[model samples]
Target: MAFKENYDSGETELKSKTSQDSPIHCSIDEDHPCDDGLPPIDGGRHAWLFLLASAMLEALVWGYAFSFGIFQKYYSTHEPFQGSNNIAAIGTCAMVGIAYLIAPLPIIGMILLPQIARWVSTIGVILMCVSLALSSFSTSVTHLILSQGIGFGVGGSLAYTPSILFMSEWFVKRKGLAFGVVWSGSGLSGVLFPLAIEWLLDRYGVPTTLRISSVGLFLLSIPFLYFHRPRIPVSHAVVQRRLNFRFLYSKVFLIYQIGNTVQALGFFLPTIYLPTYASQMGVNELLSSLTVILFNVTSVFGSIIIGFLSDRYHVTTCLLITTAGSVISVFFIWGFSSNLWSLYVFCIVYGLLAGGYSSTWSSIAHEVQHANPATDFSVIFPFMETGRGIGNVVSGPLSEALLKADGWQSHAWGTYGSRYGTIVLWTGITALIGGIAVMARYLKCV
Candidate 1:
């Protein structure tokens, strides 16, 4: 009855008729069938080129935020903002956190005013660059928070949301892989930027590094706009379908989002704390930075692999795979790590598992869209990202509290003996809770 009702509404639907069935079916956009003379859905020169540009833009936009651990390390020890409490909040909560939180706004705007998508993206880039430039002039932590944290977060949200919208239009069958390729850019840059930022911070200090970064990103991001057009013509989108929120009440989305939010709570903990943790362990600064690099490098591959697998498997299967690996890395590898070898192992293992978590979102969208065909990916995707943002905003302060909490330390050896032990346990527990969706799946709640 529901599918017939959705079919009458001229909305797209997956070939599979039921939610219990695997979503590995042809996604038919009944509103714009193949005879419509539009560009091909999955594979075309324009599509691949667009995907490449999106990936590169993803790297440029998110790379800096991903590499904020280096900035966090620098701010804790350097002049001006040194000895300031909650320095971690600038990167985790203000920049990345706020971006994820407010991302739905620009996306909502784009849905309403599809014609201005390119201009919005351009404005977002300019805002991000300007934010970085303003951050260079900061003399206090508050200034950095406003400029780098809030300003860049707002700008990045504007610039990035259009890609997600256009991307949904560009590739359907291979949407998971498309998202994987695009998201890998963040991890790819994560590999390169940490070393580069560390070098610049050491050589020219924070102001010069921030200024140079702002200029470099502006030049790099501008060219990608050429490839960022929507696969569907905007004139067709002018119909302005009513926004749907029925899927929000579904058990399937709720279960997956609970897992997603819980996972995000601990997802950023390692990236935010790893460099400083290594430096405190008597590792050289270069080696300390290398930890972030290794983590990001594995994530690049992890995203691609998980994306590929998601296309062929169920979303819960993919979620469980990533979750199991992540929990193991946190509990066994990171918890006992007292040396570079074990720490490096944790970064690689954890990055591969958890870094690929976001890539599974496309599949989640697919599943949710199946249940509520009238709801578009544009609606579901932003809400999913907002869920993650909830965790990201809380993680910075939560991590700080865990680090400062007393009675967790012991007169022993390894990570359990150190002040970081509580942090490690918290990370593991949250990661474990993040897998709760699998149980819900087994229980037939969906």
Candidate 2:
């Protein structure tokens, strides 16, 4: 008789190994004889200090990310470079590189432990500050790409990673609440920074605006760097030898991996195009910029509320609610709307829902991992971020293609007519797909 393989034993073992929710990861949390990885989040002096400092750091880096729409509007409409939406988007693409692109390295570093990652990331701040200062002098996109995109992207990712690492370590039971506060910094930035940049751009021009932002980013980096300590006791020297491929073969993680891939394609299109759409509506460019600010402001409150609710209620349902809100807001309200008020209404509703989904990443990721899922998070979050990055890039060219076909930019709504409705229609479909995946994949819970 031919020798039989051990496939049946492995299949039975793998299913038993996964968490109660779904078969996403071969969770060692069940039998791994070890200390629970996270540290206490007692409101100690150090914790509060680090939290406040972290909040400021988040405010600067993410503020820039959220307010890119304001910059997009200015660049698209202003002289010397009255460019199309695609060209203007390159700057924000730099921001995307930091968030979606650089997600992995730091997670790897965070996994190794605190000391090495923390000190290494501190050096990242200097690199970012210098890039901002250098980019201020740049006139060409290549220069911005080099100084802002490459240098700042590298630095910002380093700085931002620790904030995430620390959140997992410090706040366990209250992780959702703490995460809501930390992530809400972007919404705060979205609210205030864009409006401020508009004034600075009008008064000082793009170059000057960049210089000012760099100085502020650099200053904010200091206090946070001083206080960010890791509470988790991770061993850097141990070579966690796991030759078994059992954990890699899970159904739940596979589904989320697939879900994240589809969702990423159209996520940022609204933040990127809202101002352009406003301009198309014959709204003043300055007021158009305010649309982003308003959305972000609304997001600040929305994130906190949603995050709190997720802890009490079902996270998957919360995700569905947000996804459904985004689809309806985009396809029906944003797609058909012509005037400023209708579009603005859509933006506010969308912003609130959008904020809910964005801030919940940490909680959902952690909860899915449940009491102990270090490995699951290590595996999944990067894939989700990768999906988001691809989604952002895809949307840019997509907007360009639709605009070329429709000549919507030159039509009555100006740039808005050419692209806004198209973006809403496309992104809504993708978000709906995300909702379907969420419903089907997590339906047992619902």
TM-score of each: 0.92, 0.81
Alpha-carbon local distance difference test for all models: 0.84, 0.65
- Candidate 2 residues 81-157, lDDT tens each? 47533454464456564456677667666665545866755777777788878977866666666776667767776
Clashing pairs in 2: 23-252, 24-253, 264-391, 265-391, 280-413, 408-418
Deviation in angstroms for 371 in model 1? 1.8
What range of 10 consecutive residues in model 1 has the weakest lDDT sum? 18-27
Which parts of model 2 have CA positions greater than 4 angstroms off? 1-42, 84-86, 237-249, 367-379, 407-418, 442-446
Per residue, candidate 1 scores C-alpha lDDT tens digits across 288-361 of 99889999999999999899898899988988999999989998888888898899999999889888999999
Off by over 4 Å in 1: 1-33, 235-242
